[model samples]
Target: MSQIRKKWLETVLKYKFNHDKPGSPTIWSPDLEKISRERIKEIQSEKLSVAFDYLYEESQYYQEKFKQAKLKPQDIQSVEDLHKVPVTTKQEWLVNQTDNPPWGNFSPLSHKRWTTDGWMMFTTSGTTTVLPRVFRHTQHDLKMWAWLGARALWAMGVRPGDVVINCADYGPAVAFWCLHYAMSLVGCPVIPCGGMNVQRRAFFINTYKPTVLLCTPSYALYLGRTMHDLEYPTENSSIRIIITAGEPGPGIPSTKNRIEGLWGAKLHDDFGCTEVAMTPLGYTCEDEVNSVENPVNVHLMEDAYIPEVLNPDTLEPVREGERGILVVSNLFSEAQPILRYMMGDWTSITREPCACGRTHARALGGLHGRPDDMIKIQGLAFFPSTIEDSVRKDPELGDEFRVELSKVGDMDRVKIIVEPKSAIPKSSYIDPREKIQEKLKGLLGVDVQVELVPYGTLPRTQFKSKRVFDMREQCY
Candidate 1:
C-alpha cells in the first residue's frame, strides 16, 4: 500500500476495533425502533435550530435571506417554527450563481481556507442546464464516508475479509473512489475496473474471481449481457453479493431480480450525493427489502450538518410518504456552510419505525428520480426511470436503450431505441419494441414509437447514462 493508504487503513482499523464502546446502535437493534416519533422530532428540531444559527453567521446567502424574511434566529424557537422560515429551492442556487459567477454568493469561506491535506474533490454531473457543483472533502470527510460505507457493507453481510470488485468509475467521481476506500476499511481487497469495456471486465471477473461486485445498474446489465453472449454462466459465477449505487436498480425488484439471476449474486442498494460530504443512505440486512427503516445519521455529525425535505410546489413541509425536493443545511462546515440549501432530487420522508428498527428518517424509495428528469410526451409527462422500469421487466430486451424525440412532418414523434437481449432467432421472439410501446402508452398515457436494434448498438455509459437523445429542432 502507498504511505497515504497505509495510514488510512491504520485509522480504519482503529475505528472498527474500538466501535464497541456503545455510543451508537449495533448493526441491528430492535430497541432503536421503540424510540417514540416525538423524541426523534425533538432531536431533529434542535439540530435544525443549531444549523440555522451556523448558517446565519457564516453564509452570506442565508444572512441576507434571513434579513429579508424579517426573522431572527430566536424566532425559530422550535422545530415547528421551521415552517415559518422560507423553503429553499433549486432556483435559488441557479439565481445565486447567475448573480455571482463560479463560486456563488452563498459561499461561506474564502477559497484558501477550503484547502485540506490528503483530500479529494468530486464534481456533480449537471443533469439539467445548471453547471456542475464541486464537493470537497478533507481526510476527516474520507474517514466519515468510510465509516458509513463500512456500515453499509456490514449490513450487506460482508464479513471482515472478502475480495470486492469495484465497477464504479475512477478519477474525480466520489461513488467510485469513496466506495473503494470503504472496502479497504473493512479489510476487503478491492479491484477498480470502471467504464464499459465489456470483454476486459469479463476477463477480470473470470480471472480475479471476486466474492462481491460493486457497480451501477446500467453497467451491471451491460456486463451481464456480455457474459450471456459468451455462454458464460454469469449467474452461477463466484460473486456472492452486488452492492449497487449511483442509480437505483439493484434495489428496484425487477432490475434486481434480473441482475441476480444473471450474475448469481444478491443485490444491495445505497444512496448518496457529492454535496452531502461522504455519508450515504445505505441498506442494512435487518429489513425485508432495504426499506425506510434505517438511514446514516450524518446529522449526528451535528458537529457536521443537518438535512431536510420540502414540497417544491407549495414550499410547505411534506408529510411522510409525500414526495418533495431534498434540502440540506450543513451546520458544522465552516469552510462552506450550506444553510437551507436546496437539492433538486425528489423523494419522500418516512418517520415510522422500520423493520430493522432505526428511528432515523428514511428516504422510503431512495431517490425517486430527479424533478427535472421529466419530459412531456404527447402532452403527458414521463420520467425515464419509469420507462426503464417498463423496459427492463421484459427479460428479452437488452438494458441499453435511449429515448429520442424528433419532429416529423406536422406531429412530434417519440422514438425509443433499444438493443435486443440476445442474438438468438429474432423471428421466434416477440419484438420488445412493440411491447415497450404498448406499455408506455398504457402507463404514461402517451403513444410512443419504439425502434429495435441489434445487441451492442447503444453506446455504454461509465457514470450517468443519457437516456434521452432529443433530435427535434422545434422542441428545443
Candidate 2:
C-alpha cells in the first residue's frame, strides 16, 4: 500500500475496530460467520413460523389477511411454506392506520402496552397526497441495527476513538436515530450536524475533524459544494471515511469516484430501511462491490427478525441471481412484529464465494431500486434513480434536480427540472437546457423536456428527498 493508504488503514484499525490489523487475511472475524444457505433457510423457517403465529393471533391486520388467504401458523412449516402467507404492502399498512388511526392493527399489542421496553414509535414522511405511517420498533430491533451498522463501519475502517460527522436529520424518522445509536455503540464520538447551518457545519468539521462523515450521497455532494463555497479545503479535513445511505454512492462507480475525489476520503455505501431496522446491507472492504460478493447477514439479532425475497406479482421465491422484492419479519418485536411484510425494494442474491470468506448471502448490486419507484411512459418502464445516475455524470449539473410526471392529453409526459452547478457559468449567451435534454435522451432513450430552474428554488428535504413529482396523481 502507498504511504497515504497505509496511514489511513492504521488510523482506522487503531481507533475504530480497536485492532491494529483489521484487513489482515488471518483477521477474519465477521459476526455472520455461522450463516450458510441451509442455516439461513432453517432460521428463516423457525422465525417465519413464530412471526406467523404471533401476527395471526395478535395483529388484527394480519389476522384478517390470514383469514383472506386461508393461512394457518402450522401451514408455515418451512421457509418454502411462507408463500402461503399473503404479502402486505406499505399502502395497505397506511390504509390500516387510517381505519384504525395513529397505530394500526399492525401494532402487535393493546394500546396500554405500547410504552413498554421494546416498543418505540417513528413517523415517515407523507405529502398532502398520503398520510404519514407511524412505524413501531422494539429495543431488540434497534440492537440488531447497531450490530449490523457497527460491523459495516468496522469493515469500512471506522475506528473507536475516531469521530464521525452525521448530518442526516433526526425526528420521528427511524433511519436517523438508528444511525446515531449505532455510532454510539461503536464507541465513536458523534458530531450531530443534522440541523446546523452551512457555516456552523464547516466550523464543526474544522473543530472536531471527524474521521468519518455520514449522510445521503446527495447531501454529501451538497456538503462538498458548501465547503468549497466556504473556502474550506476538504483535503485539510480529518474525514477519511465517507459513509452514505438513502441512496447508493459507494457502489455506483461514477458517484463513488466523484465523492472520493471531492472529499479526499474513502466512500462506503450502506442500505437499510425504517420499517426494518437500519444498517441491513453495507460494503466492508474496497474491492469492487460487485466483485466482493457476500453480505454481512447482519447477525439478524436472529432472535429479532428473518429475511426473504420473492416475486412481487406471483409471491413466489425468485431463483438465485434474479431480482425480487425483499420481505422481512421480526421475531422479538411484540409491540409491532411485521409478518412477511413486502418492502418494495429489489435485490439479487449471489451464492458465489466472497473474498471476505463470509457465508452470508449478498445483495448483488446493493439495492437496485424500489418496485414502486417505477414509472411507465409510452409503455416503457424506468426508474428515477437511473435518470439521476445519468444526469449526475454531467459535471455541469448540480446535485439537485426534479422529475415531474404529468399527463399531456392521454399520454404521460415526463419532464426534468435541473439546477446547474455554479461551475457552469450562467451567461446570457448559453442555454444549459438543451445540453440536459441531449444527456437525458442519450441515457434514458426517451426524450424529456428539460427546464432550467434557479439554483436553490427546489426544496431540500432532510429525510427522504422529494426529487420526483407525480402530477399525474398516480401514487401506487
Candidate 3:
C-alpha cells in the first residue's frame, strides 16, 4: 500500500479500536454508540476528510466523480458539505462494472492487494437485470464487519452463552458470513445448518436446542410452521431469539408478530445492503422490541456512517421525522467506502436517544421497501411491504404470498395469491381469503382479487423473498 493509503487505513482502524468494546455486556462501544451527537459529528467530520482524500487519490471512479462535480476532496471536509457531492446510484455502479468488467474502479482496493489480502466477493441478486453488481472486500474489511456485527448483536441482547443456528445457504451473500464471524467473536457456539433441508434443520433444532435462530423473516415463519408439521412445535423449542435479515421483518408489525408468535421468540432484524456490507447499518434494539405503542425503531450506527433521508424526486434532504429515501455515506470499510450512496429504502430518522441508552439515529417504522419495489395501480403507488404487512396480519393465512399485477381490460388490477393455514380446512379458506382481501383493500386503497391456493402450494424462501410479479406488460 502507498504510505498515504496506509496512513488513512491506520487512522480508520485506530478510531474503530479506540471506541470498540468487544467484551462489554450491555453496550459494545459505549464511547461510540452512546456518545453525544456533537462528538459523533466531529468524529465523522474528521474521518470524512481523510476518507475523501484517500478516495480521490486511490479510486479512479470517485476521482472522476469529484472532477465531474467540480469539487475537490478538500471541499467535502465536513458532514455539511456532503450535499455538494452527487449521489451515487446502483445504476452508476452497474454501468461502471459493465465498462470495467469483473471488478469495478469504484473500489479503492487494487488488483495486487486484492490478490494478497482479499477476503470475499459478494454480488446482488440481479433478478431484474442480466449482470449483477459485484463487490470485493479485503481481510481488513472482514475484521471491521465482524466487530461492527458484534456491536449490533450485542445491542440486540446476544451474549456469549447463546448458541446460534444460522439457517442461510452460506452463499456469497454478506449477512451469513458477517453474522457467523460476529457470533464467533461473541463466544457463541454456531451450528452451521446451511445446506440442510427444513426437516433436517428442524431435527437439529429439536435435538440440539440452539438458543438463537438466524435466517430471513420468511424462512423463520416457514421453519416455525415446518417444525409444527414435524410434530416439533417451535413454541416448545429452546430458541429464544430469531435474528432476521435480507427482508423487512420487525418493521412490519404483522410479519414481526407472526414470526414472534409462531416461534415464541423475540424477532430482531438488521438492515444492510451489498455495497455497504461492512455491518448491519440499522438494527433493532431491546427498547424497540419491548415497546408496544411506538413504531419499531431500527437504530442507525451514526459513527460508522452518515445517513440522510432525501426526497425521492427532489434529491434534497427531508425534514427530520419525515419519510424519504435513505442515502448513506459509509465512513468505514477499507475496500469500498461509498459516499452518499442511495440505499433507496423509505424511512424517516430521529436522533432521539433510544430507551436502550444509545443516541444514534433510528429509522422509525423501519425500512418500508424500496422505490423500485413500489407498485403503482391506477394512480396509486405503494410498496410490496405494505401488502406483506396486511397479508401476515391474518392468523389463518400461510407464510408465503404472491402479488400479481395485470391489466384487466384498460384498468390495472392486482391479484393477491395466499394460502390458508395447513390446519385450516379447504371449506374454511373462503372466510380467511375474504378477511385478507378486506384488510388489504383498507390498507392499499384499492380492491384486490384474493386467490386461495392450497397449503404448501406457494414456494417458501430461504433468503430474500420475491413476492411481487408485475405482469401488466406481459398481459398487454
Best by TM-score: 3
Q: Using TM-score as the measure, name the better of candidate 2 and candidate 3.
A: 3
**What tens digits encode model 3's per-residue C-alpha lDDT throughout 1-476?**
67658767877887785233463557888888888999999989888878888899899999999999998857787898889889999889888988998888999999998999999998777765787778899998888888889899998888888999999898888887899998888789999997899889999999999999999998998889889988997886999988999888998898888888888988888889888645899999878888895359999988889999999999999999999899998888888889999989999989889998899999998887777888999999999888887777777877789999999899899999988778877775556767777888998999999998878899987888888999999987
| lDDT of candidates 1 onward, in order | 0.63, 0.65, 0.86
Candidate number of the best lDDT: 3
Clashing residue pairs in candidate 2 (N, C-alpha, C atoms within 3 angstroms): 15-159, 15-160, 16-158, 16-159, 16-160
For candidate 3, give the lDDT: 0.86
Ranking by TM-score: 3, 2, 1
TM-score list, all predictions: 0.82, 0.82, 0.97
Give the worst 10-residue stretch by lDDT in candidate 3.
17-26
Q: Least lDDT summed over 10 consecutive residues: which range in candidate 2?
A: 294-303
lDDT of 2: 0.65
Global Cα RMSD, each model: 6.2, 8.8, 1.5
Better of 1 and 2 by lDDT: 2
Off by over 4 Å in 2: 1-31, 127-129, 277-306, 424-436, 453-459, 472-476
Clashes of 1: 3
Could you tell me which residue pairs clash in candidate 3?
Answer: none
